[model samples]
Target: MPQPVPPSWKDLGKSASDLLQKDYPIHGTSLEVKTLTPSNVTFKVAGTRDSKSNVIAGDIEGKYVDFKNGLTVTQAWTTTNLLRTQVELENQIAKGLKLDLATTLNPEKSTKAAILTAIYKQPSLHTRATVDLFKGPTFTADAVVGHDGFLVGAEASYDVQAGSITRYAGAVGFSAPEYAVTLHGLNLSTFSASYYHKVSKDVEAGAKAIYDTKSTTRGVALEVGAKAYLDNAAFVKAKINNAGVLVLGYTQALRPGVKAAFGLALDTTKLNDSAASTAAHKVGASFTFNS
Candidate 1:
């Protein structure tokens, strides 16, 4: 088989943007302010001003670390119906074992949610498990184990009111220094597979295929993306999916503690069908400052 060609800097940027959007969707305009102290403490405040919706949302967070005991604590507040507070703690139990706990509280309503997670690692194996008891009587549990480049994971959620398992998922994956592949099945009906390869030191590419067996369409959606580094400080990326959606993004570092980014998405399929209907375009910009 022929080897895949390395992506260009532009492709690399687009791939990064695509993955980032999966975890953190871009709203209108946003600003983030962060500060770090010599004592290993940090503070952050971030907000989004969406002129389109005439709304503003923001959060403030503080974190402290105790290097001696391998312990870390984080507290955050967000604008909720009645300002919500959340706290997370992580501590090393032993050389290869760690524990993590987090909780969110609604002071006005006297409601709270909590989760606990544990991780253990050895020279050849790593494992993590988490339990979430957030809503009144429902709960969720998930666990994953990895060894020798191979991984297996499972997750299940229960509804106390219904007295049954509401959701479940399982995944398997294999990873190497130059390539990785993963397959996931959710609720026994939805399945997704992903493949990634490092074409070169400065470039990489990936693809994902998804199908829902229970759906009427029964068609698989394929997404392909690539990313490349222009240099140490800047890059561009692009991705296109079976749905005919295209995304492009770029990022550059202006200087220490300052960075800028821009992204755009277009409906290529609409443009192909009719020039007049090609109105699905979005653009976003963000700036970050650190001290």
Candidate 2:
């Protein structure tokens, strides 16, 4: 019988234990290394124009990475950043300055109208640069100088449901948040310095003052307005464009990265000393895409 085969099993156990002990440290270190991923990294790529609309409109750019520890990188290409085009800028000016002749004045398809026709169509022939400056704050001086289109202050109108007429005096003023600056205490046609501020994320409040050179008709007005984002895809705004009317608008994000903006504007204009007022409502819309 014999205590005989206590078995070589003891030798097998010892070998197994030795192997486990030797590998334990290595296995733990491997796990720790996996957790401590490298951090320093960088990536770059080019982008193309966004063409969500019939016309291409913007540029794109993209990137992501860390640069602290080792090089662990991530990156993305970006879209081109396209700004408003000359045509788009001209459209904005037209929308802002356009008069509704179909209703305000009699519609005519003829080659003859009046000072009004020239007033309405003058922008079309003007260079793109002139068109861009039409309603902009920076151009009142130039407008007064007659280097381009007329300024808002230059034309005073009196419109009513009965009739309306506008007297072109060629005036200009710098519109600002608290106050406006005029060229001369007399020449309301030129503004020296203009400043404006946002009252809220969607609201703006401001004022403007103009001096009359030929007459003692210096005047000033207080203004208030709002811009509302209806949704991630839509928005509406109501702002005062001039003394007589308000501007109301709606904009929709039509597609992924694409948008359309449209507005119905009401302008109050004076035609004569009668102090009559009229309505000139216009609807304008444009589409834009950002890649």
Best by TM-score: 1
Local accuracy of candidate 2 as per-residue lDDT tens digits, 1-291: 111111111121222222112211111111100012143222222222222223322222222233332122222221222211110111233532332111011224222221211122232121111111211211111122221221233323333332433222333333333333222222334332222345555543333333333445555433434555666677566555337656566667778756665555555564342433322444444544544
Candidate 1 lDDT over residue span 77-106, tens digit each:
887633433333334546766777777877
- Could you say which candidate leads in lDDT? 1
In order of appearance, the predictions have TM-scores of 0.81, 0.30
- Model 2 RMSD, rounded to 1 decimal: 32.0
Name model 2 segments beyond 4 Å from true.
1-195, 202-204, 212-217, 221-223, 267-279
Instruction: Give the least accurate 10-residue stretch of model 2, judged by summed lDDT.
Output: 26-35
Candidate 2, residue 235: the lDDT equals 58
